[model samples]
Target: MIMYLLMGLTAAVVSYGATWGARVVGNRLELHMPIRSRDMHSTPVSRLGGVAIFLGVLVALIVASQSFFVKDIYRHNFSPWGVLAGATLIVLVGVADDLLDIRWWVKLIGQSAAALVVAIWGVRMTIVPWVPEPIFLENEMIRIVLTAGLIVTTMNAFNFIDGLDGLAAGVAIIGGTAFFFTAYWVHRNAVLLDYSDLATLLMAVVVGSCIGFLPHNWFPSKIFMGDSGAMLIGLLFAAAGIVSTGQITSGLYDRANGISTVIPILLPFAVLFLPLLDLGLAVVRRTARGRSPWSADRGHLHHKLLDIGYSHRTAVILMYLWTAVLSFGGLAFAVFPWQPVLAADIFATLLMGLVTAWPYLRRGSDEPVA
Candidate 1:
């Protein structure tokens, strides 16, 4: 407990300091991405805020790894070096995009290459409990591909949802905190004990990064995360999920009769359902309209919220609320058994769904913004 708290504080301080430094350097360097055609911000903001977050997280990891109190936390089969290399690749690519307006294809290629590196380092998903393992490919290959795909998808999903001030950072913080508890519980349960410590450390890094950046990023934002911060956060989330699922005890598949192995894997997804769903919806909407999926537009759910009379602060808060609801709700279900927790989740989700859709449903009427 002490180790985790200390690590979290270190990460938060470093991330916050990095953001301040980035803002100064970014202004001097004029590092900014051009306003997308559909952008809602009236003025340009520095896009290099992600540099700070990346650095902060990197520093936090270094500190945690070296600390006596936490050395054992990540000394097992997990490879922090691989995670760092992957994060560096994404950060470099994102920074290039923010500064030079790199084409979408270029960014995609970079992300794929980075993901492949992580996959090759053996950080991929290979099992889906209850389902027969793929016959054609070896377990190693399956792990690499699945892990790489998750890394790429998560990186992009996070970038896609960075539409509103504080939205991405807030959600990242909430999701990270939820993962921390889940991993801690798994540790206590003695299931995947080898990886539990590392998982907790990773969660601390994420939480620190988000909390440190929130002050400057909240509504009436001074700076944006740009590709750098958003992509890094996504990668961290993906890595955490991989770590959690990878820690499952082998042969437990045969022991658990009714539930699927996907139960643990789905936890991260449930925590981040909103952003991933937004990404999926964006892809489908763009394809349906015969537009490039990468094309920027005001059709995002956040934009829709704004269009439907939500103040900027209200929209951001609403996003935060939903993120917490889903993330914590998922954690609750995971900590408890299916029957009781699932019932609670169902009731909570239904209430949230109604509230979330309320804005859209009342669009035609003269309803006041509640």
Candidate 2:
């Protein structure tokens, strides 16, 4: 735990400095993103923030490699290096798209290629980790495909919700924190291991990067994460989940810890609920209108909140709240008694719903929201 915290702090410090450097370099290179019709920000901003994030992750891994506590991970597996390789590929693809406004299909191909890199390097998901019986994929090809699909889907989902300033990074911070704690807990209690593993270490680094990046990214932003940062964060987020799932074992299935076992299957989706929901709705909404599923539009959930008169910051906060409710609720179930966790989730859900609809409820439908 202490070692993971140190790595996280190291990542945060590096990311903070690198972000400022990235902004300066981006400005010098004239790499700012111009205002889009659907975008809310009025000023052009640097989109090279992904470079800083990748640097942060890379440095953190390097620091980890030097630590005796993390030596076991390096000796036993190639997953960490695979993540770095995949991140490099995706970040380059994203940087190109940010610079050239590349075609959507080309970006998808790049994203798929990045996903395949990690999957082929042994980050593939081989087991479902279900309760009654864990479903194992015997064929290596199927595992690779499944893992790649998950990575691609998550990358797109996160990109879709990156419309609001700080939205994507903020969500990653919250989700990554939830995942880190839960994964670490599982390793300590269920796996009976004292040292941190790949998933928790990755999550720690990811959360740290986001923490470092958020001050620049928050509403009334200084720089946008652009496609590069958004896709990089999404890829790392999904990779951590894939590695975490593979860590589950039958030991978690004990009757006393049934909830903990179930969490391994559900927490990944739970943490990503909002982004995935927005992605699904966007795909369906676009398809129904005879447009490409990936077409840009003002119909996203965040857009709706803006349309309903919530201030930009408020909408982002509401999204953050709901993310916390669902994700932490799942985490609580695994770590605490179910009855209390259930009560807390219900209360939090209702509070979030009320906060979301309060504008409409306070002001009659005939009047605009204050």
Q: Which is the leading candidate under TM-score?
A: 2
How far is 76's C-alpha from truth in model 2 (Å)?
A: 2.9
- For residues 1-370, could you state the per-residue lDDT of candidate 2 as single tens digits? 8989888888888988899998898888889767789989887888888888888888999889889687577876888899889999999999999889998999999999999999998488988777676788999989999999999999999999998988998999998899898877766775455455888888989889888888888878887788888898889989988887776664642422456457777788989999999999999999999999978899999999988789999899988988898888888877777788889889989988888988877677667658
Cα lDDT of candidate 1 equals: 0.78
Instruction: Tell me the TM-score of each prediction against the true structure.
Output: 0.91, 0.95
How many clashes in candidate 2? 0
The runs of at least 3 residues in candidate 1 whose Cα sits more than 4 Å from the true structure, single-residue gaps closed, are 73-78, 129-137, 191-196, 250-262, 363-370
Candidate 2 is scored at a TM of 0.95
Q: For residue 290, what is the lDDT in candidate 2? A: 100
Record all residue pairs in model 2 with backbone atoms less than 3 Å apart, i.e. clashing: none
Query: Model 1: per-residue lDDT, tens digit, 10-81?
Result: 888988998998888887887777777777688778887888888878898888778875777556655666
Q: Clashes per prediction?
A: 1, 0
Q: Could you tell me how far off, in angstroms, the CA of residue 166 lies in candidate 2 after the best superposition? A: 1.4
